[model samples]
Target: MNNTPESSFERCPVCQGSGSLRHLVTIREVPYWRCERCQCTLMDARCRLSPDDEQEVYRLHDNQPEDPGYRRFLNKLAGPLLARLAPGSEGLDFGCGPGPALAMMLREAGMQVRLFDPLFYPNHGALAGQYEFVTCTEVVEHLHHPLETFSLLDRLLKPGGLLGVMTCFQTDDSRFANWHYRRDPTHVVFYREATLQWLADHFGWVLEIPAKDVAIFRKPLSQPPVPGNG
Candidate 1:
């Protein structure tokens, strides 16, 4: 495989930083690039699947709400988030897949939850209001425009609210070629811990890694006026 830079791939989709991305590797003929500025890896845009094809791939996932193993998987994000959320706090489950097991779990925990997914739910109105907490589990990797999507997440969150994200962190570059996470064609972007930290700094949110592959960011609360400054 030729490792030369592709002309069309100029900027980092996550940070919008130009000249900072280098051709990382080609796996199964799909080109992936690494951005020095944000420390995130992304698949070449040209290689992404079309909407119909992507939806078809998603349909194959059997993430049922009644599945005990699936609930345990979602609990990784839910446990920490529920610990911080107040009683009856409103939340949004961004990119809730077809089954929406996470949303079900949150609702059962005494919270008002709304669902949003471009392919599954497609509720445009759901994105209009801010919430006390927003959860994006196993979803960021599929983002085509991550920068904009993250900005939207920031907008969706209320002051001092929490944004819980769960994704398999890309730690070892040597194994990236054969990594199962990268093998999924719909997964266009890969994030490292540094990449998540960059997002926290960019959005002015405080980040916490409560568990492996789970990051919770708290939107900073408005500071009170200093004494004698008013």
Candidate 2:
């Protein structure tokens, strides 16, 4: 039961499903919608930034690989993931940002990590290779096409592979208007805890909330049927 009227019906970008989306907030005159089904909050397509503008915003981030604070920030996702993996497993740091500090951290733990960032380190070969796990740290919010991006991750992982993601969960609509995370012009999507669970259920992956802002999903050994294959 969507509280908003049928006029708000726009297919959810994440799930590509029919859902009622209410106008959640308006920041700097940019409207964002919240889907009742998946609980995904997405910026209006008209409010999206141009490629050049997006790149410029990413370029301003100071997350150098050697920066101590940045390294600590990455450890939030890396530490738990390292503990779960088997010895010497290979992984991909998806959307590793310009610095790729998470890749560095994984390498330090004796795992082979390949880096891929659309802007900073574009390596098609890395995406083609299968990995035991994938890390997407602080990356999902900036995704313009999350369903495709996540499907790509699904294809890149081997059986029983892990997908670890870190992002500030969107909670409380009243607080959203002034939320710091939503202020970033490049962050176009927001996820609630339910949204993450919905993704796991949709994809047949096992979901776990390991820590604040961190969600881990493990792929089943056997692939599930495609949505319409039955």
- lDDT of candidates 1 onward, in order: 0.90, 0.86
For candidate 1, write residues 71-139 as lDDT tens digits: 999899999999999999999999999999999999999999999999899999999999999999999
Ten contiguous residues with the weakest lDDT in model 2: 2-11
What TM-score does candidate 1 reach?
0.94
lDDT of 2: 0.86
Off by over 4 Å in 1: 1-3, 223-230
Clashes in candidate 2: how many? 0
Per-candidate TM vs. native?
0.94, 0.93
lDDT of candidate 1?
Answer: 0.90
Clashing pairs in 2: none
> How many clashes show up per model?
0, 0
At residue 164, give the lDDT of candidate 2: 96
The RMSD (Cα, Å) of candidate 2 is 3.0
